[model samples]
Target: MGALALLAGCGLPRSGPTRGEIFNGSVLREGDAFVLVVTDRVNAIASVAPALGFSSEFRDAGLVGSDIISPGDVLGLTIWENVSDGLLVPTGQNATVLEEVQVDGQGFIYVPYAGRIRAAGNTPERVRQIITDRLGDQTPDPQVQVRRVAGDGATVSVVGAVGAQGIYAIERPTRTLSQMLARAGGVAVDPEIARVTVTRGGHTGSVWFEDLYEPGHDIALRNNDRVIVEADTRAFTAIGATGAQSRVNFESQSISAIEAIAQVGGLNPSLADPEGVFVLRNEPEEIAEQLTGQDLVGTQRIVYLLDLTRPNGLFFARDFAVRDGDTIYVTEAPFTRINKAVSALTGTLGGVNAVSSAAQQIAGN
Candidate 1:
């Protein structure tokens, strides 16, 4: 009995440290800065639940019109007159073809005789009417036709983590966020963890790439809008008595504590203590004040304790949210140490018995 007790006290093979040992190691030089919190309904309510969403301006922005022209657009104009000697065209030509007429930066396009006219804010049909009216007195019943050529006037820049990066025009088919992304050859990273950010006129909004197709998320695009697709960088460290001990990236936009544990293959069933699942994080000063009664100077070192034996323990875990950079540690069961010690002692006794039997046989011989 004494030998077994001594073996257990000296230290036996363990998957991880015990709950009491973890608490003992948490002490700091300044004081007991580590605040241990019991996971409950009250604490779960105060836990951080972070999510990405767009504001009203991002969601309520109007769609870009299909036929609208901008300053950087290219226009093709064909002019015809009733008489043989047309005003803008040559006498023998009957009709004049003006190819690749680029609209200037100030929204003006200079026709040969029509002078500078605004074409940026008007549709191709509207520009045609304006040009016909401009030559009405001199040309006598002039017929003008305006055709829009390819240009970057109403284009949005698609860059970062996409299969292809370029400036894509916001046509009728590619007016929404999802359509624009598809036009850019789609995201290169995993859709489960990809993030899409839209920056328009200095206003920025973001959403999970998986949620882009959802309702109210596929927002309308605008001219010169910058669409950036980036892979999620949020992750947490899993250590101690869990199945895996590595940094697990967030597989979804939001994950609860229970889901995070399952991502790491759950706690080690044979060695884990049901009541010793812990999450270690440095809580912000404001949030720490809410959790603890003290107004901390900087980030407070928090150790959130989760006891799975209680009636509402599972519910608490389901409600508690796990943030990025958090370290999830599960302590070993108390009896696991004693069991390992007993196994070691049993093996030692068996070896001793075998040696003694061999000595007796040799002596008898």
Candidate 2:
């Protein structure tokens, strides 16, 4: 009875989850709130992906036409008339020069004979036509020319992690995003880990520098657009039985779980349980709903399980997208903890034997 009681009392150490027990099919069936997935190449990639769509920020950047003028733009006007002693247009002088007429806060420019003309929101060419029409009868065949000298409205400010940081004027009708970055003295951060942000009209959007390598990603820039280039803060943590338990910054925006694991020095071969590979992430409510077939309220902290012992495990790992702030954990093998406990017990027993032997020798003396 005593022996049976001893065995029964030490039935199990309900400490933490064992290697076999965690991330298994049974966990999903147990009606646990957390989501567990058997990662497949197709589904793994689909799981971490947020519904990505083309940005509307630079939609009009592709539009070909004259650059539109805005408030705070400096305009230079030159007027010429055939008749002598003209009121607004000088005949004796080559042209009546109105150098640096800054566009007002109300988006209007003061012309000598044309009164306050709506110059903002219209191209320089459009403004010239409006002014010429207004002063047609007053001056004989009035020839007007409009030029942009210096203006905050016709320029963009490039700030953060750049060689040169200042307002860059759009001298030409259109400047591509790449061209603007080059003019601003290129990006300071590694191109792979850099993120470019554009803010305009109270709306903002960002894209990784790696995206610029694509054909159409190098979109054009508009007047008064604020472009910021900064180092990417997105990172993932590798913990547990992995070779290195540290935070790893993404070199590129999208990296497969396989690449991430490799970058962190693949799992500890001796200690890691191949079946216990897991990724913990706070999944968005929408994603949780799609995975579990139920609407998840608030932040759904989901744990994704990957069985690397399976045949297609490597392929799944390659396809799985590791997201920012994700925790990649490779649980220790069952035997590893048991071996450690045994070693501690052996060391304790050896110390006790050495003490007993020394005491026996002293008693004999």
Candidate 3:
């Protein structure tokens, strides 16, 4: 009888610790975690400030003239003179073509008798005027035309989650963020959830792909600018007695707690505790301070509770904002453990009755 009692009362297997077990271990005994009841008031508060944008330094670097020349740019020069025998013109041809003149490291280019002329920081037309003035003393009635033949000038690299990754020249069409992304063949990921980041000098700025056309986000491209297109990586983990235990990625710019639950197929109907839905995350100090009404330093571990059995519970969950790196857990129902215990007890009783019957049969034989 004692052995049977021990066998029947043994602990049953559970997917995870129940709600009471977690509260007793972390809240009541350890006192390391704080539990906040999820309500309309709590849902209204922003858990933590999001880092979803760029600073003024990036926004202030607005649009600039896209045709300005830079060092290392390849210039194409075609020179024509009125006289057939005039200088810079070929003997048989009426014009002289300098197909590939490279801008020197010091922002100057040598043009035969024109000597070292400044080309960088000047438009192609401005450089043409400078060359025409320089050659007028030697060549009579000189006509000069200059155009950027190949991009070595102001260029930005487009990489990460784009259709084609390469160095693109910051030309007139590809001067802004949206234009540049189009020049790079658009983002490989969905534009709604994609992110575009521009890193210039020591400062880095980012904005959503869909927001790149917004006023301040469509900043001008600069020399050596690195533009990266990527998808949103923020996600929350769904565990415990929910339909599935998996890390679910954020589907949009923002996700509500109820939506997160639905992503993991919602709570398991048979085993889930309707009153034990919890979201665990390290909340910022300001929020923790507001909840506890105390001065707290650094981030605090918070376990937010949501009871779906209440009248306003679903509405509160709908309003709750689920943040990145949060863990949503749904505990098993209390009666599940009781059912497991009763099932074990019934099996034990059946075995005992069978054994007693066999013993009686043997004694009678």
The RMSD of every model to the true structure, in order and in angstroms, is 4.7, 4.4, 4.2
Best by lDDT: 3
TM-score of each: 0.74, 0.81, 0.81
Residue-wise C-alpha lDDT for candidate 2, range 293-330, written one tens digit per residue: 66668767677777788888877777788888888888
Question: Order of all candidates by lDDT, from best down to worst?
Answer: 3, 1, 2
Write one digit per residue (lDDT tens) for candidate 3, span 1-365: 45545643466777777887678756547768888788777776654447578788776776656787888889999999988787778788899899999988888999988999998878898999998998899978799999998765678999999989999888888888789889889999988889888899988888998887766667778888899988999999999888899998888988888899999999899889989999998988988888767788999888889999999999888888899899999999977766777777788889999999999999999
Please say which candidate is ahead in lDDT: 1 or 2. 1
Kindly provide the TM-score of model 1 when superposed on the true structure, using C-alpha atoms: 0.74
Question: Over the full model, what C-alpha lDDT does candidate 2 score relative to the true structure?
Answer: 0.75
Looking at model 3, which ten-residue stretch has the lowest summed lDDT? 1-10
Q: Over the full model, what C-alpha lDDT does candidate 1 score relative to the true structure?
A: 0.83
The positional error of residue 346 in candidate 1, measured at the CA in angstroms, is: 7.3
Off by over 4 Å in 2: 1-17, 20-37, 41-48, 51-54, 61-70, 78-86, 89-100, 145-149, 213-216
lDDT of 1 at 156: 86
| Candidate 3 or 1, higher TM-score | 3
Cα displacement (angstroms), candidate 3, residue 154, comes to 2.7
- Model 1, span 302-356: residue lDDT tens: 8888888878888888887888888888887877778878999999999999999
